[model samples]
Target: MLTLRMFIQKSDVISFKNMEDLYSRLNISKNLKDEFKSLISELNDYLDRYSPLTINSHEMRFEKLSTSEPNPDQLTNRELMDIYLYGDYAHLDSSKRVRFERIAQNNLFAPMGNHVFVTIVNKLVEIIDRAVEMNKQAIEQLKDQI
Candidate 1:
């Protein structure tokens, strides 16, 4: 639910994009859209160094993971993040069946991947919370003028 609300774009749902716009319209100092992009960029760097895969995948099954090193060739953290978000958490994408299945069957990294994903989501919520807090006093004053 939080995944969809934060990542997915639906007309009926209030997403991070929507919140970004709202923050802008409310004249909040921070640009939320840019902040989100920065967060993703930081996450990508971290992911490249330490992938979602566990250090001890050698102890478990390796059939699902084709390569000795986990994670697909040239597949960015951003791509995997989107795949996991849509395929497992929120709405299903028929077009992503192949990639999605790859992610689903990889049980060895599932726990670590899920933990990282949840942490990302938590960080997003924190950013939003801070944005709201930063603008609270100004917003309260604006309300009185109206």
Candidate 2:
């Protein structure tokens, strides 16, 4: 995740965030573009599903956020990065640490959050892998033509 934060995320977000603009700049074949479009759509969906934004973190709960709520799962992809960056991995920001600690101290978030965090993270990794592979193949094909 650190590597993602430092290096890959910059490019990863750009490549997928606005596919129409990026696609307009590319010289990919029709079939390849279609495939890329589908992949990008799915990738973006998962990316949206899992974000680093912490706005909704306050609503997260172990079993459920509220008894009246339908899903109860408030965990977002955005909140996971905080746990890794502030709570566990870097552990630098005092303010973030406090927030993360409060969230972590929750009876349910401590254990179940780990499981949920890892599962979604793995899915993100798999999507990123596919995007990287496709980009590499496209670039290599372009190189061959040159």
Which candidate's lDDT is highest? 2
lDDT (C-alpha, whole model) for all candidates: 0.51, 0.58
TM-score of every candidate relative to the true structure: 0.54, 0.61
**lDDT, candidate 1, 1-146, per-residue tens:** 54434533535445545554555566433554455445444544644443333223233222243436654343434455566666665677764444666545677655655665666566556655655664465577467778
Question: How many steric overlaps does candidate 1 have?
Answer: 0
lDDT of 2 by residue, 63-142 (tens): 33333433423445555655556666663677667666766777755665566567666776776687677778678767
Worst 10 residues of 2 by lDDT: 47-56
Global CA lDDT of candidate 2, please?
0.58
Q: After superposition, which runs of candidate 2 have C-alpha atoms over 4 Å from their true positions?
A: 6-8, 11-24, 50-60, 63-73, 90-96
